[model samples]
Target: MLYFDHSASTPIHPAVLKLMQDTELNHFGNPSSAHQFGQKSRLVIEIARKQMAQAIGCLSSEIIFTGGGTEANNLVLWNLLHQQKKHVITSAIEHPSVLNVLKQLKEFGVTFTIIPVDHACRVNPEDIQNAITKNTGLISIMFANNEVGTVQPIERIGKIAEQHGIPFHSDAVQILGKIPINISDQKITMVSFSAHKFYGPKGVGVLYLKKGTNPKSLVIGGGQERNLRAGTENTSCIAGLGLASELANKNIAKRKTHLEQLADQFKLEMTDAYPEIIYNGHPEHSLPGVISATFPAVTSNILIIKLDLQGIAVSSGSACSSGSVNTSHVLRAMNMSNDHNIRTLRISFGRDNSKEDVHLLTEKISEILKQHHNKR
Candidate 1:
């Protein structure tokens, strides 16, 4: 089957899988132990930490491994609240992991302002600045939206937060391996990333907390991750993640330019078939791998099933909550019509995809829309 859902999750890279297998076979020991076996595992985990930190241009001391991006995000938000209780500013288009945690933080005497997105599914930095009162403590925005593929001007927003003295964090899972990142440039106090999003082993993630930022730890146990995360390191997964990060750092530019060409080809073909197709998200600032679009009059779920029957795999939106009846919160924030929400499809390319794959998908999508036009 043709997999066009890379944004949801990627196939584990062969190199990463090989490293993980090696770790499990040869370094299967509790990293907390001081014995030779455990010592070997601990050293491997430390090297992985340095690799992840280097990928983001941060110090090794700033990297904290977590179960995944969700936990990393929660750790940042919870700790920032611990530092001080105040209002938070987050975009309406954030992943549910951040929004859900923000929802829970309401009970902790912390209020929040959910900034709305424009037609391109981008949050206005001005709106964020306007939403901040004297009491705003933090501002959290995703670096790249998962469903819509909009890349926010995070560094711009970060500058705003800097002037206001508010801690700023970004959920960088979607953008980690796809874009060039300099966490220092954004003045980002905390950044969350998942290895699975970048073709690495799953259940491994990193949280970058800037030096001297001092976000408190939520999980308390034996000293690990320099007391930020208090659990035994997953040496195998960490090794896999380091390999993936290194590969991504080396291959980002070529992958980005190639994927953009593929995405453009797909969009152009599909648009020729359905002239009324509406492209969601910012055209220029979007990730090269993702193309979100809506076909007139036809619900995406129905069209997707038709494509799947023809051996194509795509998604209606975020994999986390796709099968549900609700519209995407990102689309809703843009105040798009119900048809825009219902007809939306997110087809994301990956390292394995090619222009030929796009051509086949385009032909299949054309057939589906043509059949619908005839029915009407």
Candidate 2:
């Protein structure tokens, strides 16, 4: 199948896959054990952590391993409960991980302000500034939206958070490999990443907590991840993540250019075929490979199945809420109509995609639209 869902998860790179397999087969000892095998496993995890830190320009000691992006996001947001000020400032277009955690925090008497985004799904930095209160202890914003692929003004937001002495956290799951990240330059206090989103193995993620920012430990067991996160590490997956980080750091520019070419080719062909087609997300400040296209008369659910039968893999929105009947909260927050929301399809390109893949996708979409019109 032609996979166009890179935002959900990327296919593991061959090199990363090989490393993971080798590590899993040869180094199966628990990292907590004091034996030679355990020490080797420990080394593997540290190397991965260091690679991730280097990729984002942070200290190796600042990284914490977690189950995935959700856990990573939770680790930061949930820690607000232990703070003297329990209020957070975030955008309305955050992933379910952030939104859901914030929602649940409400029950614990921790209030939050969800600043609204504009029609382009871009959060206004001024709105976030206005929403911040004296009690606002944290500002959690996503680096790039998962559904619409709109890159937020995180650097500005980080500055605002800094001015107010609030910790800034970004759900950077979609931005890691696609964008060049400099944690210190951005002034972000914390950022989260899932290895699978960057062509590494699944079930592994990283939370980059800036030095001098201490959130309460989310998991308390043995002394792992500097007592911030506990439990045995997934050594093989961590190795894969390290390799993926190294690859990303080396090829960020190359990958960005390629994906932009693909996205440009796609839009040119798609707009030529359907002039009324609507593209969501910021046209200027957006992820290169991700596209959110809305077809006015088409039902995305039906189109998704039809495309699937033709071996074209796409998604209606976030993979987590794929089959749900409810429309996307991201689109809704941007004031997208219910009709347009239902008609929207998220087509995300990855390193594996090519010009040929774009041609096939647009051709199939045209063919399907023609069939639907003819039937009607």
Candidate 3:
């Protein structure tokens, strides 16, 4: 099958798989134990931490491993809200992991302001700044949007948050392996990551917290993960994540160029064949491999099923909310018309996809659209 759903989850890299298998076979001890086996496991976890820190340009102590991106995002929001019931500013197009957590904070007297995006789903840094108030304690914007692939002006927003003394947090899960990340230079205080999004094993994620910033622990038990997250560490997955991060750091340029070429080819082909196609997201300031296209008069759900039947896997929206009847919140936030929003589909490329794969996908999509038009 031609998989065009890398934004949801990527296939694990062979090297990352090997690292996990090797770690699982040799390091089976609890990291909390003082035995030699346990010490070995602890060392493996620390090495992985260091590797991740190096990749993201942060200190090893600043990186906290969590279950996944959702937990990482939750931990940050929970900590900020628990500290004070102040207002938080976030873009309307954030992943549900961030938006849903913010929604739950209303019960705790924590108010939030959602800054809207433009037609291309790009959040304006000025809008974020204008939304900030004296009561605003945190600004949580995504580094890059998942569904539409619009890259936010995170550095600009981060600077604004710094000037206001508000902690800036970004959901960087989608951008981690797709672009070069230098968190230190971005003025961002915290960022969330999921290993599975970057060709690593699932169930492992990272929350990068700047030094001198301590968020309250969400999990409290054994003194694991510097007492921030409690429980025995998943040694194998952590090691795999480390290897994946290293590989991503090393091969980002090459992979990015490849994906961009394929994405461009696919769009050109689709637009050439179907003049009515409406492209979503910022055309110039988006991720390399991701595209959201709206096919007029076509239901995204029906198109997705038809594409799947043709051995082409794609998504109608964010995977987390794929099958939901609700319209895409991202598209709605962009002020997109109800018709275009309902007809949108998200196609994300990955390292494994080729130009030929794009050709096949576009050809199949053309055929499907033709069939739909004939029926009409």
Candidate 4:
């Protein structure tokens, strides 16, 4: 089956998988133990930490491993609970993990302003600046949107936050492997990433906290993850993530060029079949592999099923919100018409996809549309 849903999750790299298996077989000891076995596991965790840190260009001590991006996001936002009567600035297009946590923080007297995005699904840095108030303590925005793949002006926003002395956080889950990242260069205070998004095993994530930025720990019992995250480290998964980060960092430019070419080919091929197709998100500033479009007269749900039956895999929107009767919050924020919203499709390419896959996808789509028109 052709998998075009890389935004949802990626197939683990074969090398990463093999390393995970080997790590599990060779080093299956508690990292907290003082014995040699545990020391070996501890060394494994530290090495992985250094690998992840080097990939993102951050200090090794600043890297904290979490269960996933969701947890890493929660860990960052949860710090707001300690401050009363605080306000936060975030974009309307953030992942639910960040938005939902801010919602819960409301009960504890933390208010947040959601800056709306433009039609291209991009957050204006000026809007974030305007939303900032004396009570503003943090600003959280995704580096790139998951559904529409719009890359926000995070560096500009980070500069604004730095000027205002507000802590800035970015959910970099979607952009981690697809883009070159230097956490040290950006004024960002914290960043969240999931390994699975970058051809690594699931259940492994990283949080990059800038030096001197300490968020409250969500898990507190034993002294694990430098007293930030407490649990037996997932050594095998961490090893896999370390290798994945290294590979992605090494080949980012090459992978990005490949994915962008595929995306361009898909759009060019689909243009003739559906002249009325509305390409969503920014034309130039968006992620290379993610293509969000609205095909006129075609409901996304039906189109998804048709594509799946034809051995093609795509998504209506974010995997988390799929199957819900509700439409995408990102589309709504961009002021998309309800009709257009229902017709939207998000196709994300990955390292394994190719020009042939793009051609076949367009052919299948053309066939589906022709059959659909004939039926009508």
Task: List the candidates' TM-scores in order.
Answer: 0.97, 0.98, 0.98, 0.98
TM-score of 2: 0.98
Q: Which sections of candidate 2 miss by over 4 Å? A: none
Q: lDDT score, residue 163, model 1?
A: 94
TM-score of 4: 0.98
lDDT by residue (1-376, candidate 1, tens digit) is: 8999999999999989999999999999899898999999999998998888888888898888988999999887787567554788998899998898889988888788999889998888899889988888899999999998999999899999999888898999998778898776677888999999998988989988888877667888888887878888889999999888878888789999998999989878877767788888998888887988888878998888999887889998898885688998888888987878889999999988988988988988888877888999
Let me know the TM-score candidate 3 reaches against the reference structure: 0.98
The CA lDDT of each predicted structure is 0.88, 0.90, 0.90, 0.90
Residue pairs in clash, model 2: none
Return the lDDT, model 1, position 127: 94
Candidate 1 Cα misplacement greater than 4 A, ranges? none
Looking at model 4, report the run of 10 residues with the lowest lDDT sum.
77-86
Q: Each prediction's Cα RMSD? A: 1.3, 1.0, 1.1, 1.0
Residue-by-residue lDDT tens digits, candidate 4, 1-376 = 9999999999999999999999999889999999999999889889889999999999999999999999999998888877753798888999999998889988988898999999999988988888988888889999999999999898898899899888899999998778888888899999999999999999989999888876777987888887898878999999999998998887789989999999989999999778888899998888989999998677988889999998899999988775689989999999998999999999999999989989999998888778877888
Model 1 lDDT-worst window of ten:
77-86
